[model samples]
Target: MKIRISWWWLPYGILMLASNMWKSALFLLLVLSLHESAHMMAAKAFHYEVPQVVLYPFGFGASILHLGHGSLWRETLILLAGPCVHLVVPFLLIVLVKFDLISITYANYLEQLNQSVLLFNLLPIYPLDGGRILLNFLHLFLPYCCGLWVNYALSVSLVLYLFHETAVLSFQIVLLFLLFQQLLSWLFIKREKEQFYYYRYLSAPKRIRLKHPFQDCFRAFYNVIRFEKEWMQEKAWIRRYFEKEDLKKRKQSHQIML
Candidate 1:
């Protein structure tokens, strides 16, 4: 897959170096790399071809190619893998320190870095892991385009709020750059007719039932089936279908308890 660095990342890297935080910056980049690598591994495991990996100021973003060929659950898993790595690394670091393989101070620094990265990504802003996860969650109930609009709106609002609260010049500049990118996406989505059609198809049901089980498989199937009924006239049928499924599951669960 192709990799490209964001232009904003260049200025941020320079600032870090100028401030004599080059070592910290190097560690941060390595942490981000590990985060993105987790995502790449998940995508690859599912046979999804990642076309590009973009290195941002905070972390890397991977674009999986041929999204239509991939399952939504797989995509969600890929997004989640990044944060999971950050969450899991601290324990591993603790083990290393316990074994005297690494200094406690070094382990603590890495742990803090991982936590920072995790918190930044968990923010509910578009393009971040949290925002993507939120969007995926919304897609479970809302129409695909509606979910995109909501994600964009949340991203815009957060960007503005960050600009207001932020005092750091370098960070403000990065936020502005992110805002610009969001605006461009908004414009494209607004003006392009094909985008609507694409979302519809992208959000369309891939199969009546999942061929194989994966994480959150039932939830994913339910969402797909819900999305399929989104454009249908008879909304009652959709509700009834879900009610029946819920009842069936509850019955099976009760039987297991007995």
Candidate 2:
């Protein structure tokens, strides 16, 4: 997605628009950095590889790579990290501000920005934090399409709510744009589902159905191991039986010749 950093970040940039203030867009970048950094850290905890952090109209996300066989707990932790940091960082900064360690203006800015990031991310829609976390958990019970569509429904509702928000036009606009983007995203996912499943099925030798991308890979790997074990057991059984029969036949032939 050709997301322009300068365009969608107008609300964030307004914070640092004054002369000699270098924090304009950088503060938002810092927010994104915090979010994706947490995700990458959690991903690495499970030996998954994180390649890029994509910042969008809605929020920021990390594109994780080499996530071969992630478990529910692992994905959930990674999903939760963004909000956890958002919540904790502001609280810590407030503590510092109360102790006269940091300026009130700076502290307030951080606090609001953090809150904004958290609020924006926690929208219960797809491509958002609450939505994504919901999807990760939903994968335990339903297919990806089901979870994705649920998120999309929520996002559409969110867009409807935002469109009528009289106080926050920028936020409303951002929400609408995000809703469109994720709607497109959901469609793309639906189209690519068969292809992703096909590759996953082909990659592993065992006959396992592919649904969850990384988890399915693990299932396939386990199936391959099990198949190998069964093949070994059958081979051993056949060899033992055939050898025993051959020896008995030889003994009979020797007796007959005598």
Candidate 3:
């Protein structure tokens, strides 16, 4: 997987060094690395390829290309793995302290860092673990598009709220700015995302039955389309959709010729 460091990280690291908090900075990096490693391990467990890992000032984020394309349960587990590492690290630190492998002071600092990272990651912001888990939960009841839109809305709202509450020129403002950038970038590719969703569904259609399949195909992530009391697979629906588009294009061409 490719690794990239965010531009924000350089300034943040410089500040930490200037403040003589190098130990804290090192511990924070260690914690974030462990957290992201857990996610990568979980993704591998589910046979998903991690294309890239981005290191932010606060934490690390991994891009699992096929995440959420298959079983929701597997996706949820992968997302949860990062937080679970934070939960377990404190205990491991305590064990190290007991064995004199680390000082009590160091252990305490690590524990606090662990708690802070865990809470921060659990915030409901898009692309964050908490936001993704919320999206997955919504997908069960809402259509895929609806759930994604809701996720984006909530993420932007929360980021805006945080910005308003933060002090001017504070470090938090930088983090919030980065998060807002991420949301905007994701929004710009909304159409591409929808097309990818359709392609994934068509390529590996799941067997899902619904009372009415005539509804919007993008409504739910796993609902099969039904037409005239017969269930239609994703391939058939996509074929029909393309055929309609082709017919429209042909008619337009004929009119232009005339």
Candidate 4:
């Protein structure tokens, strides 16, 4: 996958250099890279197409093109992979220390960094791994649209609460950026939902069974629903939806011509 550096990284680097914390910044980047690499490896194992990986000042984020179209179980595993790296790395660091490959002081520093990164990433903010895991779990019970709304709402609330509790100016700025990102997502939620449905329409269907017809289709598996004691395939439902949309478009065009 292609690698990109975020524009914010430049200023962040400068700030770190000015503060004489460049070493810490570099170490954090290394840790973040390892974290993202775990995610990439897991995605590859599932044969998902990873388009690009972006490095932000805070951490690294990967763009997996078909991530949302896959089974929820696989998605959850991919999301957990990054955090699992943090959990495993501390033990690895201990091994290195025992072997005298690294000083205990340096190993301690890395361990602390790992913990900090893991904790920050676990915050229930949209687009974060923790937020996504929460969304995936929610999808098991709630309609896809309802789960999305709940995820966004929780993200906004948490960010607002962070703003009140945080005293660090730089961290506050980061929180503000996250808040802005969530607002943009909230504003374009309808468009996102449409794209989500379109993707589901194009992807291969799975034979998952559900008891009731959800407002939106499957988030984890492509479902066949037993609604009112009749079985309904998700593919057929989506096909009918597209047909209706096409008919509406044709009628609009015909009326405009008249």
Q: Of the candidates shown, which would achieve the greatest TM-score relative to the real structure?
A: 4
lDDT of 1 by residue, 1-258 (tens): 798988978788788878998776776777788888898898899877788988887567788764422355777888889888887788888888999988999888888877877897888877778877877787665544566688899899998999999899977986887788788878876333233333334443444543222111222342323333243312233345456667998999999999
Q: Report per-prediction Cα RMSD to one decimal.
A: 14.0, 15.4, 4.2, 3.3
lDDT of 3 by residue, 6-32 (tens): 998889989987999887787777788
Model 2 agreement with the true structure over 129-208: per-residue lDDT tens digits: 77767666665555445655666777777777777765677677677778788868766863444443443443433333
Using lDDT, give the best candidate's number.
4
Q: What is candidate 4's lDDT per residue for 1-258, written digit by digit as tens?
A: 698989998888888989999877877787787888899899999988888888898678888876655578989999999999888888888898999988999999888878987998898898888888888888877777888899999999999999999999978988898899989988988777767777887784555656466546767666666544577677677676678778998999999999
TM-score head-to-head 3 vs 4, winner: 4
Q: In model 2, where is the ten-residue run with the lowest total lDDT?
A: 216-225
Better of 2 and 4 by lDDT: 4
Residue-pair clash count for candidate 3: 2
Ranking 1 against 2 by lDDT, winner: 1
Candidate 3 regions exceeding 4 Å error are: 55-60, 99-102, 166-171, 202-205, 211-222, 226-232, 239-258
Q: Which stretches of candidate 4 lie over 4 Å from their true place?
A: 57-59, 95-103, 211-213, 224-232, 244-258
- How far in Å is the alpha carbon of 150 misplaced in model 4? 0.8
Sort order, TM-score high to low? 4, 3, 1, 2
Write the candidate numbers in order of decreasing lDDT: 4, 3, 1, 2
> What does the lDDT read for residue 23 in candidate 4?
72
Residue-pair clashes per prediction, in order, are 0, 0, 2, 0
- Candidate 3: 10-residue stretch with minimal lDDT: 211-220
Give candidate 2's TM-score. 0.62
